[model samples]
Target: MSTLFPALALTLFTPLFGGLVLGLVRPMRLAGWLNLAFCALSFGASLLLARDLLAAPGGVYTGHGLHIDAFNLPLIVLTSFVGLTTAIFSRRYMLEMYAHGRVTPLRMQVYHAMFQGFLLTMLVALGTDNLGILWVAVEGATLATVLLVSLYRTPESVEAAWKYFILCGVGIALALFGTVLVYFAAQQAIGDPEQGLTWSVLHAHADGMSAPVMAIAFVFLLVGYGTKVGLAPMHFWLPDAHSEGPTPVSAMLSGLLLNIALYAVVRFKMLADSALGQSATPQLAGHLMMGLGLLSFLVAALSLQRQRDIKRMFSYSSVEHMGLATFAFGIGGPLATFAALLHLLVHSLTKSAVFVTVGHAAHIAGSQRIERIRGLIRTQPAVGWALLLGVAAIAGFPPFGIFASEFLMLNATLQSWPWLAGLLLIGLAIAFAGLFRNLQPMVYGSAPEGQVAVRANLWPVVVHLLLVAWLGLAIPPLLAGWLQQATRLIAGGGF
Candidate 1:
């Protein structure tokens, strides 16, 4: 019982400690191994913390401005799991890059250190109880990821990194402004300026807060966090960043980081719901989300048809899926909210799996251009098959967790907004066609010249795929209960 706090502390601090050790070490190999071991340890700690959270579901753990609740416990676990898997995948992947002279030993050390820093920032964001501190944590993540995005030091990579930094930095600043506004709204209720910004205090007195201030605060928070969530009109930086960065970074960006930003938005959404009443905030937020989501879905579907880069195509697919998840939460009902949570889980797992395979394919084919990388099936069967299956799962194929979640979301949408349901189906079908058309040539066409067989780290890919399959086929009762409890929290039920 007493071990839970230490486990939580370890989960938050291990990565930072690892990053420091890696920075001081001379040899790149040792640094990489240390990064991997530290991530694994952090993941294990997260699992222990999750078990504690589940066993004592109603218990509150507070430290200074930090709060651990059911809402963020699962998220911390998922984020840590992705960080661990990505670190494992990076070991061999980075080594391969080093062998090719694409990365120097010093740069590899930097990559390892930055990766841990990125993980630490995400953990801080999820675990912090102070709204202002959460914004700062997210800002730290943005800065750390900017360094990773430009690791290659190419012109395109630099450009992508710059764009990502500027856009997200502005967005995060807006989020900070929104946080201040939330504190203002809560000050009257909580009666202490500092404690008013704590999530527990804010939520506890939410019903007594000023609705107008809450409404304004939500607008800022949505636009700010929505940019990070890759919501359309604000998602321009996402594709370029994904396409230009290393594929492993792309996987982490799509699979884990984006979800963390969305988690932040959902937390604020929950706060707004409590402050302004559920019907007041959710309705406005949902409509805006639904509109932006549909726009992103349609635009990305059309954009996918014209993609020349394989990574860019998948990047668009991320936007589309994110739009769908945003739509689900925006709809704001029990079933829709539950489905949104499911979609987040499945999308993170499946998208990361896809990127792992894509990274291997790009390595073997020696190019990310979609047309040049043909006959993956002939060149490397494992990677080719993984890519195909991963794409299928992401494109909403049945017996995949995404399909189940999407179906639930659509059902919920249809019951309330039939027109939006129609639009969702149309966008999905269009995106599916566009993605598969590109996938076919890559999977089954003639092998191009100069293709090389590379060693693929199949473990991470297999682990993610298996989780998606199992979750889709038969979710463990305990996991389902956790999801339900999380949904109930978002739905404003204490139990």
Candidate 2:
């Protein structure tokens, strides 16, 4: 475990260094290459961490600031992979923006810098075993993303950035309060400030801590991090941010950032559940998750039917998926946890692939409005088919990764909460209908007047969809084993 320290360091600091370098670099072309180089390095480092995980004992910590366990490593790997793929897609997307004269060289430099910084904060948040540091890292990611969302400098972009900033800022503040409460609970037992705030310390002593305090702390944590996860009633900022930001940023927000926020919540949930044990308080927290998850899923599924913006439609899809994943985790069994893990993996891959194709489609049609963009199959077959494949995967079509996870979730939910299982089925059906309704007109008809298709980098989209397809058909032994480990860790750690 100690041997993996350097890989972890590389994984954490590469982005910080890249962001600093990119911010000073003048040439846009050089900056793009540097971004990809750094992302690739980080991805490689994460793979090394995976290798170490396979060989090592339980979780390891290089001190308390950085730690790796089955629970967080899957997320760490997914983030690095998405970071690399997004870099590849964005190279051309941003170049096209340059061609359109919508972005100056300085803007390009800032984009690259903020992009690295965003990745850095997520890595920090995921790697940390300290609640206070995790909060700081999440806040950093939020601030960095606000810069990315506002990069276009349009009125809509600026408004969306402000909305993200304000909403997530409040959410972060609430999360801080929750953290303090947990630490306070720990202090009552451990009687040491430094030890009280440590994750492993809290977990080891959790069952002895105040159950009522754990319950209240989890409420604040769930609402706080749920806000960042784009759960309904706190989700107004998500669609606007996705619609107005660069397509690459939209992809990360839905695919990466939301997951990172949920990662934080998962850690807190595990702690809270451990502290409360079989007390009704733990079950109450789980019920809160189910209730919120069910509400978000149903609301976002219904809301998707009304979106005119193509990006907004997919943004809502993200919300629905996050809600479903949360509900699965809330159920807290090995099967449900495995399903949640699979859903998170597939959703990240598929949603980002969809956005990559959408980025190109919007470029082709000169608009992101669903009513305005048409004939993608005719005008740009690659982009059209990528979108088709992605949409199918997201809609939970059979032989797709999402179907497998949803199937597992339903199967598990039935054994415990049959009524909630029925509700899950309804929400999935509604979301599917909403997606398919808008999908038909966009992919089948003639192009709107004055729109022209353009070439795109489709490799990233193709690779992601193929991976999702593979997962749906057959999850590899290695991947399956890893996910199983994660499921065991989350299930046992929580209760």
Candidate 3:
């Protein structure tokens, strides 16, 4: 009998299997049902993985060539949970598309299959022990999502897909070059080329590696992965892609995929800290990240004020939140790192919930333009309330997980760099203003004509929002402990 951790294998491959089956199936209805089942199974397995991760006193799970630690385990669970919720939301969302004659049955099957494949890529990215494998997985996700983004085959969608492909392809190439440099650095220390790219192996020898090469590699890796992270100057593709893609695709892009990419950056940053010493790498990376974060925060805040499309507005918000997460990690302390992880969780949940609600609103209102749609409360109260609450949570309103995480981040910054803290506060205030300025007209004004009631799947939105809200008020002691362990590992303690 082959004995292995069921959660790992199941999480990594179930979606691939499901995607294959969905592709082969004849009927669209069966494809949807199969996708739901596969996602549900994956989610259940992820919960089990989270349990196993929590139950392990040392927070380590090592089997075969794989290492499941506190850092990646929570990420895996988050990825799977988002995948499951998106799957559930897609059932009704896509069927609505079919009813509107926007897609054929065969096309729906393709979408379902591709959705699973996308999940598989994200899972593989989060679970891999090798840095090179993680890069490949992220690139694979980029390709899969390009297809999903262009599923509608409209001129705008195709353009968005092309932009996504070009930008990400360039980014992946740079990342590969950086990966090669890292391998070379590791080879000098460990004297084995093959083992050089393994994360655990590299971490073991990081301190012994050449500092200059590692520094150069870190720059390449940051710029490359930063594109995927949606940091400024490299974020041109995000808005178009999110605005034109299927709503579920947009949700996953913002909620799960960006976090996985940032995780890769954090992993490398950990390695860099080990290689170059903590003070050197942390300060260098922190300054650059904070600069980029400030730029993204301000740009997105102002951009939000000009957004005519509702989803595009949120896409800018995604860029801003990604910036905030990057800045938190850049600060590189126990408190900031813990806040980064918490921010990732809350942002993923809240953004996905918001997008699901946005999809429902778009469906009922028959438009994506913010100016054309008004008075969501009068039209579709469920989606209206969900959007309002989601925006509030994402904007760092009181009693929300985002608020708690942001507050923690600010406190950390204030202790170390009070000037940076002030800058962060100003950026946050700007964002709050822009978000509310756009949100008021969309949610509280007069309802426009052509609005029809949609059979919205409010369950996923409700579940995600509730979780985000709960995390704000109270974090489970166990989860907090796991985050603390992960934070310590990133800080310097060997996992």
Candidate 4:
């Protein structure tokens, strides 16, 4: 428990310091290895933080306007783990891209720098206790990713970056306005400007805030943060960004960023629920989340059938999973919230693995177009098998963590709103068909002339998929207990 403070500091600042050093380092090999080293340091710190939290009295740590509880501790660890693995995957992938003259030397430097910067922002966003700081961190991540998305400087990549910038910029501005409203309410209730902006303080006094003000604030907050979550009607930028950006960046966006944004939404929802519990529309926030979640789920699943680019297709899958998690959160019960948390964990792991495989597949085919990628099994058995298995896990196949999480969510929906179960079933079926439709041809169809294997690192894929399998087969007692604690925090009770 005494290790908490230093661990937290290292987890948050390692990347910040790494980015500074990497920006100045000239050798590509050194830069790449340094990136991995920094992420490893951060990941190690997160593990220490996790251990400290598990051993601590209440599974929490708070100091210097930062807080860690069951709710965010798992997420911080997941973010760091994915960051480390993605760094491992990216070294070879980006080095190969550099070999082919896809990225200039300077752009590579920027890429490395921005990668660390992005991770730092994400860690800060998760660790901060102030809503204002959280908003700033999320915005900072958007900026860092915008740079990464445009690293290639292709017209398509640049266009996608601009779209991501404009949409999320507007969305985050709305979130800022909502934050101001929250602070206004907090000031009204707590009457301390500085502490009013603190999330712990606001949460402590949530019930004393005006219901109408909280309700209005929640609407803005959801739409704002929901945009980052890639919910329906605000998801147009997601596919393009994922498709055109570097595959490592795609993995980061799909695996980590969306979850961080959703964490923001859930935090606000807790405040809204507390404030509105005795009001006329106690479940107003929940209803809004449910509606948007369903819309995004159905729309993204249906859109999957229309994607020609492989990465774009999986980006839609990310949207669908995030939407499903949102719907689970909206359902708001011990079962539903626990399922949503598990869904986030598995989806992040599985989807990052899928993107890494897709990166290798694209390298083998020299293109990301689905039609051009063929006979992966013949060219690279490791990549092909990893892709097939990763997608299978992501599509909710049996014995995958995704399947278990989805089943739990379905059971929860059956208990709460049985009428909507059919829609969920249809969405899952459609998404499964959409993915395999594009995937089978790529994995099993005849190879085009000159198709050959690249030096693919499949360790990350294996690690992620095995964890997903372990979770599906059985949740470890320790992880299950952590999730149960988080569930109690969110749902006001534990199973």
Q: Pick by lDDT: which candidate is best?
A: 4
lDDT tens per residue, model 2, 1-495: 355888888888999999999999988888889999999999999999888767776644446367788878889999999999999989878988998998889889999999999999999999998888999999999999898899889999999999999998998899899999998899897878878878877777888888998899999999999999999899999999988999999999899999998888888888888888867655767778888888999999999999999999999999999999988888888888899989999999999999988988888888889988798988877778888889999999998899999999999899899978778888888899999988888898886666666868899988999899999999999888778877877787321
Q: How do these models rank on TM-score, best leading?
A: 4, 2, 1, 3
Clashes of 3: 0
Q: What are the per-model numbers of colliding residue pairs?
A: 0, 0, 0, 0
Best by TM-score: 4
TM-score of 2: 0.97
In model 2, the runs with Cα more than 4 Å from the true position are 59-64, 493-495
Model 3, residue 406: distance off in Å is: 0.7
| Residue lDDT tens for model 3, 381-453 | 8878988999999999988899999999999899788888878888888888888987887889888776767
- Each candidate structure's TM-score, on Cα atoms with residue i matched to residue i, is 0.97, 0.97, 0.97, 0.99
Q: How would you encode candidate 1's per-residue C-alpha lDDT over 229-311 as one tens digit per residue?
A: 88888899999898888777999999988888888988888888777774444466566666777777788888889998999
Q: Write the per-residue lDDT of candidate 4 for residues 102-206, one digit (tens) a residue.
A: 899999999999999999999999999999999999999999999999989999999999999999999999999999898888888997788998888888899
TM-score of 4: 0.99
The positional error of residue 75 in candidate 3, measured at the CA in angstroms, is: 0.8
Residue pairs clashing, model 1? none
Q: How many clashing residue pairs are found in candidate 4?
A: 0
